[model samples]
Every structure is written in C-alpha cells, then in structure tokens.
Target: MVTTSIPTTTKSWTVLGTDGFDSLKFSKDTPLPAVSDYEVLVKFHAASLNYRDLIIPKGQYPFAQKPGIVPGSDGAGEVVAVGNKVTLFKPGAKVVTLFNQGHLGGSLNPQTSATGLGGVIDGTLRQYGTFNENGLVDMPASLNWQEASTLSCAALTAWNALYGLNKLQPGQTVLTQGTGGVSIFAAQFAIAAGATVISTTSSAEKGELLKKLGVDHVINYNETPDWGAKAKELTPKGEGVDHIVEVGGPTTMEQSLNAIKIDGTITIIGFLGGVQGEKQPGFLDALVRMCTVRGVLVGNRVQFEEMNRAIEANKIKPVVDPKVFSLEDAKSAYQYMWDRKHFGKLTIKIE
Candidate 1:
C-alpha cells in the first residue's frame, strides 16, 4: 500500500570512489528505487554517521565496498510504501535501518556478515530507500527521528557488549571509556540497568558532562595515564570493574587490562586508539588477567529490537552531538566526527 504520493526521484548522496569524505556526491535526481514484494520503501527523515561512513570511501573496511554506494548504516524514517508481501511493516510504520540486514538471530556467520549496509550494498544516505522488510526494526515510539537514527549501530553494539554475553546485573560495575556513541550508550544502558558506571574522558568539562549522565565516577585519562588502576580501585573494595567496554584497540588495551576484574569481561568494539604500535596488544594479556576478552560486531535484529524496547522503557535519550548537519553538508559532519569534537552521535537531517 502506498500511503503517500511517491516521487520519481529522491535526493541523495553517493560514494563515487574511495577518496574519503570528498567522494560523497550529492544527487538531486537520484532515481527512487521500486519497492519489491517483501520490501518496504522508507522515506528517511534523519540519518547518523558512523566511523565506516568515513572509512568506506578510503576502502579500509574489512567488508566489500560498492562503488557509488549510498554511505550510511543508521537511518530513521517512515514506511511511505510497502509491497504486498511486506508483512512486518505497513505503510506509515516508523522504522530504523538495521546494520546487518541478513543476520536476524543466532550466530552471525560469513553469509550474514556480507549484508552490512553502506559498504557491501547501497545504504540509507538517500531520502528514500527500498529495504527488505527484515532490514529494519520498529523505531522506539518515544524518540524523535534524529534520536532514533542513532540506534542501528552504536546503540546495538553497546547493548550487545553489556547484555549479550554475561548479562549485566543490577549491582555490577561497568567501566566505559570516552564519550563516543558506543561509550555513551554503554554508560546509559549500564546506569539504566542499575549498575555503577565509571567513564573516562580527555577534559574536566567532558568528565563533568559524563558525571551528569549518572556515571558514578569520571576519570580524566590525560591527567591519569594509570586510569585503568584508578578505575579498578573505584570498584567494590579496590577490585576491578565487572565489564569494560574497550573501544580503544592496541593503544588503550594496557589500561583496559589494568582495569578488568579477575574473571571479568572486556568487550573490544573498536580501534579508536589507533592499531599501530611498536608491539600490538594481544590476547595473552587478557589470558594473564584471567578475564574473558570478546569482540563485538554491531548486533542482530533481535538485539536491535531488544535494545529499542530497553531505550523506551528507560526513557533513554540518545546523546546526539549539539551541532546538527544538513544532508548537503554531510562531508563536514564526517570531518567533525573524525576531529572527535562531538560528544556523542553525529547526525544529519535528511528530509
């Protein structure tokens, strides 16, 4: 059913080649794709940028990059139209794009890994996009479009890190590093679950801001290079934290290792601290610490839906960067994320 008058062309951005942010070309007349049976046509009102939005063009991502692909994995929109076979969503249903369309539940194997958006296939940079009904989940009714846009990637990853394996308990302690999308989401989720949170940042201003988010303690990593031990000491009886959301790869792992409680879990989500080092950190350190070290891909549809429900139940608002960008000025948004000036999720208004 088509609930609204559909346009023949939709404005969008395309990654023409692997030249970084400059490669994003705006197309005023980007042809609107046809909605197939079992597909829904989403008129995206807002989209969020992730690190891959910057990396895909330079061709650094582990997965395949479609030339001239629409470069965004996180999008929030309405179902303007749906094919007859599309049962999960109807016209006018609010939806958010799933990072991995193929992986619904269970373990993510190689076949499921191939369907990551904005890289392996065309993604949500366009105003209108045709996605398989399974590629999206219901948006949390409590959130606005821009807030919902941050869910598909960072939020899910954070949820998966905390709740996927050990399942965060009420009294457990969580240590989150930095104030990026994933870190902030982790902190929020931990706080909502009634866990104590200790977060790290570069400056006192950001540290205070983190404290405002209900973090039990905020450590300035620049001021305390031994922040790991300090964070560990803040836990119960000078013991380490129960869960460490390790977004920093090689560079920050030493501190992460120093901070994890014996038999605790460290979920490595990104390499934000740079991968290159004289000697890269390895699993041996985690082994010596006697803790579980795990790596998290974004998450599956089931996790996405679960996280959305939690977000709504907790009244958790996404920490969007104060500076919003228009769809046309997306390149600047990418630059802003790269500069690390934004405190949380970087978003673009796409309507």
Candidate 2:
C-alpha cells in the first residue's frame, strides 16, 4: 500500500458568517494549500485593508460571500515553492497577490468578478497560500512588504481610476475627496503625472498633511460644505477640475458634478460617506455636462504591472498609517479602519 503525506497547516483569519466585524475569527489549524501545476505556494509577509474588506463580512458587498472564506484582498509575500509548470515565478521571488485572479487583461466580465479575492473565494489573510502564477505580480523593487501590500486594492483602484480608462494628462486638475488610502494614492499619482491636485479633508490637520504631500490646494470640507463649488473656483480660470476621484457616493456625487469641467471624468471608486441616504447623480447629470463617469475596480494584472513600473520610476511611496498590527490583532485593525481615523493604509503583519 502507498502512503501519501498530509499537507502542512497554518494559522489564518476568516469571516465565519454574515455578522460583520465580530465574524472575523482566527483558526490555528487551517490547512496550507498545495501548489498545482500552474500554482505557487507563498509565505505571506504582510497584508493591508480596503474599505471593501470591512463590509464584505457583513454581506454588504455587491458580490455574494462564500462561507468561512478568508477575509483579505491585499497582500505581499515570498514564494516558497512553485509547481513544475510555473515559470513566471520561482521559489524566493517577492510578489504581491492580484485582487482578481482571472482578470489578467482586457475588460471586466462575469469571470473577472468571480475572481475577486475575499469576495467569492479564499483570500490573502492566511499565513500560507497557493495561487496560480498568473494571479500574482512581482512586487515593486522599491517597496517593502507592507508597502507593496497596499497596492493590491486601494492603490490599484486609484491607479485604474486615473490611468485605466482615459489616461489622465499632465497640466490637468484632479480633485480627491478625503485622505483615505485611495484618495492619497490618487493625489500622488495625479501629481506624478504632472497634474494639479486639489484635496478635501474633514479636519485642519489632514488638510495640512495633504499640503505637505504637494497638493496644489486643500479644502476643509468640514469648514466648507460647498466644497465642490470651491474646488471649481480653485481651478485655472474657474474651468473646473479635469478629473474628480469620486470616493463618496450619493453624499458627494452632486458636488463632484459641480466641480468637474465639461467633458471631464469622474471615477467612482468608493462610498466612504455611506452607501444609502440622499439620491445620487443620475445619467442626466453626466449627460448634461458631457462627462464620463466610471466605476473603478482594482485594476488587472497588466495595469498592476504598469502601476508598479510607474511606482519604481517615480519613486512613489504609499502613505501608510503609523499604527501597525499583528495577525492576531486584525479585528482591532479593521475597527480602526472603520473609525476612519487613519489617514492612509492600515496594515497587518503575518508572523
């Protein structure tokens, strides 16, 4: 009789049910997945959070959640083993996981939506994981594990918003609402593209931080309720911003429409201001201004690679929050992100 060896196991965090943050629980004996012919085994080093990660467990995301699914979308790690057919990555390679495993290029479709990590399948929160070689990209040489982890979702979404569709041009003006991870990345990417950046934040201190980051103008939304009009006035000749990274949904859409130039673009990436409440700008609003409004998901692997190239070329750094957490304290990390107190990306280290 032949005997087969059992695969090793490791610790991981998962969403037990549709119960929100409290559903995030840890398991010390989760099975370590094995590499298939086109797969690679990775030893996770760090993982980061996105707003999507916060609502996924609560059944608030657009997609249906799988039972007992691991709950993380952004992660960086080192390859520990590779399947015989895996040529793109070998053991010891530093890589970042792709947000969507099936969407390598082209456009988003049902297949692409199904590939979303932490949404329809197991994700990156585990200490060890096996992924298809095509589902991962090399981490930027200039970034550390944590910094690289930040790119998988938030940074990539911001990159997709600016470069995915119409390609933001230099000398144009971009308005970013709030100082969240995506907003900061949009500002940084817009600046790198030689565009003028006008940022809005709730407090005076965050506005100062945006200034230090080289934003051309900072509007305190708390002080200026009509910040959208103010943003338009701040643009050259009051022509309005050429692009608006619209993270706030119904609450800020009308203002975004007001701030944008005729024929401008608005990338809807998040709903930090809550998904419900006031009615949002409909198609008529966009048509009236001849504007293009796009829903920005995290980019494909091709876009991810391009974003990394730009990161290395421009020496762009991710704005991560000062406080760090271990894998055991992941719940508290999510809570912090929920509180909206962190200015930038919040991360967890896997030990």
Candidate 3:
C-alpha cells in the first residue's frame, strides 16, 4: 500500500517436490506475491538451518510433510515494504521471523503449531518474503543478521527449555548434552543467568571449546558412558543439576535422569541419539526423582520478544558456524548440517 519496493520477481530456493535433497531447486525469477492487508514484505539477509531442514527433506520429521515450499525457519532481515493495514513494522525496520507464525502468546496448540514457518507455510529461503505483521519481531540492535537469524528456532527453543516452566535462577547447575545450537545456547543462557554449566561432548577439541564458552566441566561421553553420574558428582554436594538440556532423547535420557536432582527439570529438545531400544521414560522415572520432563517446541512470540530483550541487554551472541554459504549453495549447506560436524547453526546468506 505505502510501497517502497513494489511487487516484482525475486530469487528463491524452493523444494520442487519430495525427492530428498535433490528436490531443492533455485530460480532467479520466482514471482513475488503481493502483500496482503496485514502483511509486510521482508528482504531476507540471512537464514540458519535446523535439524528439521535435514529430516524434513527425507520425510523423516514427525507431523511435518515433504517440502513443496520454501524451507527455512530462522532468518533475519529488513522490512522493505508494508501493506496499508500494517502498523507493527515500517520499511527499513530490522526484523526476525517468528518460527510459528500463528501462535503469538500463551500455550502452543495444534492449530498454532501447524503455522510453523518453512513447514506448514512457505519459509525464509528467498531473497524477499511477505509475512503477516504478527509473524516478525524487531531484531535486537546488538545482533547482526547472522546472529539474529539463529534465534527463530534454536535460540528460542533453548530459551523455552530454560525459562518456560520456571525462570532459570542464578547458582543453579545445568547439564547440556552437546555443542549444537540449542545446547550452546542453553549453556550461554545459563551462564548469563549466573548458573553453573556442565556439558557433554564426544570430541576433546569440542570440550576445550566448550570450556572457552565458560562451561564449568566437559565430559567426554564416548569415554564416560556414565557421564550423567559424573555430572552429578561435579555438582555442589553431588546433589545433581537443576536442569538438563535433554537433546539426546532416548539414549541419553537415562543419563539425564542420573544427572538430575530430586526435583530438577529435564527439557527434551532433540533426538540426535539413535533409539537403540533404550527404555522409553515412564511414570516410574518421574516417580523416582519427582522431576519434571518437558518437551519444548520453539516458543511463542512473547517469549521470543523476551529472549530478544535479554540477548540485547546481555550482548549474548549466537554461535554461528564459520563456514559460510550463499543462497545458491543452500542444498550443500543442508548436507553440511546432516553431517553434524559443525559446532553451531549453519547459515546461508541471501544475496
């Protein structure tokens, strides 16, 4: 309506069909749609890949279908145009796309969950995107596009895991299970909250890096299969940790249980560890420790805003993989994410 950039063709990568990674196709002249009454146009500067980007392409993700759409959830950009009815954003405002476009606040529900960007809807792999005004938040001034792009999913999920049930308190201990985006974010958030952090990793090199990030102790899970017990022992008085960032799902849950205290919390975020007949956690597990086991989706819009304020205030920077990729190499970036060698979020610049 009050247009700065008019409706025109833009470049984008689209999953043409569900043929695994081979289905991803790029085009320079993808037709850009007109912004609706409440929609705003964004010129995406950067986007980060999540595990979903790896699994969804292979039809492996639960409740998520194959890609007939643009496939990126985390992105940071600047508003280039606004619809007549849009008031939340103006042209040139830096913004980050919300992971779930429909769920603004309160609890996440089925309908709201289905509104995940790059899943139920077209996502941020394009040079330009149009989103509902409610779907984007003001980007933190302290972060550049690359750092801000990591927030929509990984950072938000970590924030939700730590702060959802109860705000993480100072001096509590946290056990993080790897150096992935979510785990690193958890460690950073915990440290920022004045909490002690113990992390688990397979590589000694990565462990040293974790120490550099201010992790109190790094356990090599390969050597110490019972790292959970070791983690508990490291806690003050051997009581166990206040929170366990449970990314390993079934295989690592038992370890998590061992590392948790009688009323500690375990937030299940990812299932990177293969399910090798590890017993599914049951009521007995909860009964034994009287601990809370929660599953975290990314987060709601209000929480995203809250996390942004904290990140900006504390100058918390998201760890991004140094290997850069351009929009043309997004498919290759997907393969890199699948390799799981990168320490943090893999990103693509839309230029």
Candidate 4:
C-alpha cells in the first residue's frame, strides 16, 4: 500500500440543529481527524441519501444525535491514507462505509445499536472522514462512485429484507412499495433472482421507471387506493405475493397484510408514511394469515459483502437521480428528496 500526505481540513455539510433542511450548512473547512492504527482516511467522492436523512434533521430518528454533526451513512471513495494496522484497505483502494461499524457478522445488540452513523455519530456526508477498518468494505469494480455509494444503506437493507434470513426462490413474487432506493433495489434484486416483482409508486412516470427495471407490475397507489387487493389479483393464480418490502410503516402495513400470502414474509424497513394512518391493521390479521414481519435496520457487513458480489455478477447499477448536487448545495438536495420528486437515489458529489 502506498502512502500520501494527510490533509489538515476538508469540506463538509454539517447539521447545526434539528430545524429541518435549512439547518444543514456547508462547512468550508472542517478539521479532519487523524487516522489511528485501525483506521483509514477516506476521500469521499460521492454520497447517497435515504429516508432517514430527511427525518434526522427534524430530530425524529430513534437514535441520539448531536448538533453540528456530519449527517450521512452512504458514500464511496478512495482510500488516500491507511494506518499501519489497517490491512483490509490501503491507499488508492475504493471503499464504502458500513452504517453500523460494530455489527459486522453477528446478531444485533446494544453495542452495534450504538454505532449507527449519521444518527449515533458523525457520518459520511463529507470529503474526508476516518473510519475503523472493520466498518469499510470494498466497492464493486463494476460500479462507479455514485452507483457504489447507494449500497451502504438502502441497497443493503433491501438485500437483508429479501435474502438475509428468508431467501426468495425462483418464480416467487415480491411486492415493493414506492420508488425509493430500497424498493427499487428490492425490485432489481428480486428480478435478478428470478422472482416476479410487483411495485407501487405515486405516479405513472415513476411506475414506468420501475417497469423498465424489470418490475412485472407497477400499481399506482394514487390510482389504485386498494393496491393490496390489486397486488393479490396480479400474483400467480390469484395467490398473494410471497414477500413484501414494507417501507411505509403504519400507513401501508394494513394493505401489506392484505396482499401477502399465508406464511409469507413482510420486512418492515421504514416509516415513510409516518407513524400512523387512518386504519391500522390488527395483530389478529397477521396471526390468522401466518405472516412473518421482520424489521430491517440496513444490514450487517457480511450481508453487505454478499450484496456487492451479487451486484458485480449481475452488473447491477443503482438508479441515481441525474441532477448532481455539490456539498455546498446539500440543503437543496435534502429539500429535493423531501419534495418526493426523485425516482431513485439522490446523490451528492464531493470534490
């Protein structure tokens, strides 16, 4: 591994308060932290956004956060410098940060729970940040920086939902809600795995994009209010879907319960529809249906590695929003995502 002179400061987007998007400010010269023996200094090229990024600024995330913290969990960059003890990555190697640095391959616990980035601590929405070696994973060579940046959080979460515990078999059916990063990746991964994908979106435009990504059916939730029943009707032989990537929380869970087959799985990942809805499903519905609900928190490092390998083999490319934002325009970028206009991952380019 080659070595280079470390810099003293780097540019970053810092959240000054939980006052929404306006609170995010561009820091022209945030001081860089020194790399310790087990750490590597990454020069981030690009970072991607998630739904949590939207709520964190409003202090809504369950994890504790600090003011003036750099807020992001997904990025890919070159390793400009590495500590003597860092053998996994070195100078010039391309890598992305794991959302949880402590939970590499085991079950979740307090220690891993405390290590979540962007919320538990400062995250990767900056040009340079030092990460523990264990938290860094190699980016697939087949993907560019923007595409690889999408993997750390949303992509890995989708992978965990589909294949982490309950593997989807060939000819099975999956129902994904919305065209966000996680749902889109779930559709792509399910299609690659030989499963039929049924996706829901807010607009026909976004629904068309999902169809292009190999979704067999795209249900416009606005047009089809009772999308769950529609999804059930669309499945093989009128049977319900085998799995659902449930990201809408309370607002969409009732329908998810209606759309899933007996003994099916629903991986509850996010609360995009917020905490409550007009009509919430009862526990009896899940009990009677014999459906399993597994809550996903991104994923572990081992699953991330497996997802990367699959990406490489399948030539999977993340659908990044074309409008690129610089670190200085991070606030507008957040607002763009908040507006719900983007069809795929929103990204920021770091120079």
Stretch of 10 with least lDDT, candidate 4? 60-69
What is the per-residue lDDT of model 4 for residues 291-320, given as tens digits with 9 covering 90 to 100? 998887888999999999999999889999
Worst 10 residues of 1 by lDDT: 274-283
lDDT of each: 0.89, 0.88, 0.90, 0.89
Residue 50's lDDT within candidate 1 is 85
> lDDT tens string, model 1, 118-201?
877678888888899999999999999999999989999999999899999999999999999999999999999999999999
Candidate 2: segments with Cα more than 4 A from true spot = 1-7
Reference-based lDDT, residue 168, model 3: 87
TM-score of each: 0.97, 0.97, 0.97, 0.97
**Is candidate 3 or 4 superior in lDDT?**
3
What is the per-residue lDDT of model 2 for residues 84-119, given as tens digits with 9 covering 90 to 100?
A: 788898778999999988889978897787888887
RMSD, each candidate, Å? 1.2, 2.6, 1.3, 1.2
Query: Candidate 2's error at 341, in angstroms?
Result: 2.0
Give per-residue CA lDDT, model 3, range 212-268, as digits (tens).
989999999999999989999999999999999998888889889989988899999
Stronger candidate by TM-score (2 vs 4) = 4
Native-vs-model 1 lDDT? Answer: 0.89
**Model 1 residue 122 lDDT score:** 79
